[model samples]
Target chain A: MKKDLKFYRTLFISTFSLSAFTFGGGYVIVPLMRKKFVEKLKWIDEEEMINLIAISQSSPGAIAVNTSILVGYKLAGIPGALISTLGTVLPPLIILTAISFVYNQFKDNAVVNAALKGMQAGIAAVIIDVVYDLAAGIIKKKRAVSAIIMLGAFIAAFWLDINVAFIILASGAIGAAMVIYRERKRRRV
Target chain B: MIYLKLFLSFFQVGLFSIGGGYAALPLIQNQVVEINGWLTMKEFSDLITIAEMTPGPIAINSASFVGNRIGGIAGSLAATFGCVLPSFIIVLTLAYLYQRYRKLTVVQGVLEGLRPAVVALIASAGLSILTLALWGEKGISDIGSINLIAVALVALSLFVLRKWRPNPIFVILGTGAAGILIYLNI
Candidate 1:
């Protein structure tokens, strides 16, 4: 909690390098972060690291950004959060900028187009796998409400063409209501 | 104006992208493709491929990619900052409040509900892209126009994913190579 220049520097570098080299996205960064902060730096303990990851997943936006912010805040408060976030986002910003330029140049080329078209099919397959795993995980829990909500959401988006923002809001409300109702019934009993 | 529009569009993506990066795809699709027409369906799919192969989060890679396409470097900066701002604010606030109250039951319940909904959203997005990849926008109506190669690639990709469970980056790379070899002649 000293909040020194050296500490901030180290936090920025640690986050920057971890983010720059890591691929696959938010989930990939978790173990690497643990290796660095919890094991090498000993800045945080194992238990706290788990808690941070949980919070990151539950919160909105990217998990990597959220985890970096939490770790930074835990170490040095608000400024630390800002520094860590900057470090985490910079690499992607730079990499994609160059990529976009090259992509624009070759985007209309038949070969590049063919390659991307092929990749699209593969991407679609991956997305399907993600959908299956996520839906199955919820259904495996045997929660009727979750299952119904999942089906309703798919219909609403795919057929009715409803805005997803509204669906998410309604689902969150239902969840909170379920908890509140259960609490009330317990009290009455 | 374009910069501002790009910023605001991605700002919404960041704000409501509950669950994680994949969960945000449908929302991003809505903003950039559906509403704004900034990128065509093909371009959007290409963006996903690039994002998958790249080193950072999908949301950030998307913001940068879509922004660069629309408005150039300054636009990428605008969109990336927009994407980052909400997370910065929300996480900082949650971190502060979490210090005061370690438990957050309401948030937990909300996440429980949101989880199923997020899964649904991803499924819907996947179906749309799949339809485009195999059948194009006419969907099933244009059955004769369907690309057999795309269908084969999708089948092969899914089989590989289910059996080996290799890293997605490798799967995508392999598929890209397959595309080059298969389509180069035609």
Candidate 2:
């Protein structure tokens, strides 16, 4: 029991600290997590790390949290998952709470406004970087159909102001249809 | 009743917010602004700005802010948990199944199709944020030409920096300085 508590405590602290300071969300955190979990701690192998990213992205929730939960669970089971998730989430929660409390007071503050404006620009760039990486992966796979789906989705959302969920659902339907079509074709052949 | 609704709503977000936290934005905006009437559109916009600037996932930060707005500390906890639980359960289950079906071509084909859509979703998110930040009446009315310039410079610098590989922190700070300069000049 004591050992379990110690493990949970450690897991929680590590996850909380990592999540607290991580910036730019899922893509940025991936490499950092690879370093920490695979290289430093040797907690999981490279293949597992890749699988974790895949599963986390495909599954619901925040990718960072999902990754932590999987790693934690892998290391120490359900308790570890709980502890790590709490750890990963707690710091950001506390920090954002403090920010929220002070936001109104600083709403019109000049320096704060400037800093945010700058960060906004950086965020746009980071997002572009993410898109570029994804595009490269898709291109490498020679998945032109998927590329078209992505383009259509972007145009739909950007030009028409369609909701994202609808796009995702539509894309999923298309994917399912393609699978069924391919299977039928193969059977006929 | 209100708290229960809050919990259930965010729980739904947590459950289906696949592809990442940014993907959750439109749903979150709809729920908080249109459906729930918890926040004004402006407030929701501002919350997104705050979420972007902060650490952790945007969805979690938004949940905390929205939660706090709705019901203080307890509300925040409820919303955060609600946002997280669904994904956790779903991912865990998927992770287990993934091991067995890892090599199936049909499964691969589906994932291949999903990847591009995810990219498109993210690009749309970027465009939406850009429109909100740079093209609003308030944005134009207040800052006018200077804001447009800032947006252009930022976008251009981002493009260049992608090729050159400068530290992202530096780029952020530089754009911040640009904002301050624009403000002072105005």
Candidate 3:
């Protein structure tokens, strides 16, 4: 694909509209992106789209932002990446600005407060659901190491009050070490 | 100073929010609620709901809302930029490297290890939110203080989730409506 103004315009519009409209979370935007770029625009191939999604998931930061970066880069290099990010980010920034303004206005309203109080419980439930699904996924992998790490992480975060960044960094280091050790053992074998 | 603090706080959130938006919750809570006292736990829960109801990434939405609360549009811009900057740099570098070297098994391994930790962080965040909702900020000092309505809402939400598996947005909105009805009368 040619990296022209039109191409950049199209890229920006796609990411902007998708980010603006898609609700739920970061994961919800992936299929929509695949449809737009892979199926609709033919900008990216199906296989490469999957790879991009995997990379986005594995990398730090929001999946939507990361995927936009890779897709933008794949299609039009660095400028593409920047345009896509700005597109993806602008919608939420605008929307939330309006929302926070209104929210501040009604911050102390009795009706709004009551509704928010109830929503709080709902949000907590959603978080619990997420925790259950993620924990179950690790357990289902049937890897003792993964299971142990999950337990250890919960204990450290919940009970020990360890800083989360340290936990994540330590987990990543351990993960890399385990992989290196396994690779060496396989070579020896 | 507040703008700088907002930028740095969200910058850390963006840099460390591996996995996805959900994983960022605990880190964001730590920054906004625990360390900065910018938002109480109750307000933080409202922030999550607002993020859910709105479009785009939770982390992004949150930075904007919190930043706007602290400063204004300029503050929102500062925060939103801070949240996106790390991802922009990290992804650009990783994408360049990925094209050169196809084998990234170590990244996979790190993700694998990170998965469990992500779950744990999410769980810890959820538990705190749940505790705050049910027992209030004072904590479980007495049975009389427990908010049975909040507990019931959580149970109802979970039941609806298990049975229908409806989108969480509905559940959140439904609970909000329920709150209005239940509390308005009282």
- lDDT per model vs. reference: 0.89, 0.73, 0.88
Top of the candidates by DockQ: 1
Clashing pairs in 3: none
Give Cα distance to truth, residue A87, candidate 1, Å.
0.7
Q: Each prediction's DockQ?
A: 0.80, 0.53, 0.79
For model 3, residues A14-91, the per-residue Cα lDDT tens digits are: 999999999987779989999999999998999999989877876788999999998988888889888999999999
Question: Candidate 1, residues A1-189: lDDT per residue as tens digits?
Answer: 467888889999999999999999988987899899999999999999998887777778999999998998888878888899989999999999889989878988998877887898899999998888888899999999999999999999888888878888999998888877777899999
Residue B38, candidate 2: Cα error in Å is 4.9
Q: Which window of 10 residues has the lowest lDDT sum in candidate 2 chain B? A: B136-145
| Per-residue lDDT of candidate 3, residues B22-41 (tens digit) | 99998898788888899988
Q: For residue A167, give model 1's deviation from the true position in Å.
A: 1.4
* Fnat, 2 decimals, each candidate: 0.81, 0.58, 0.82
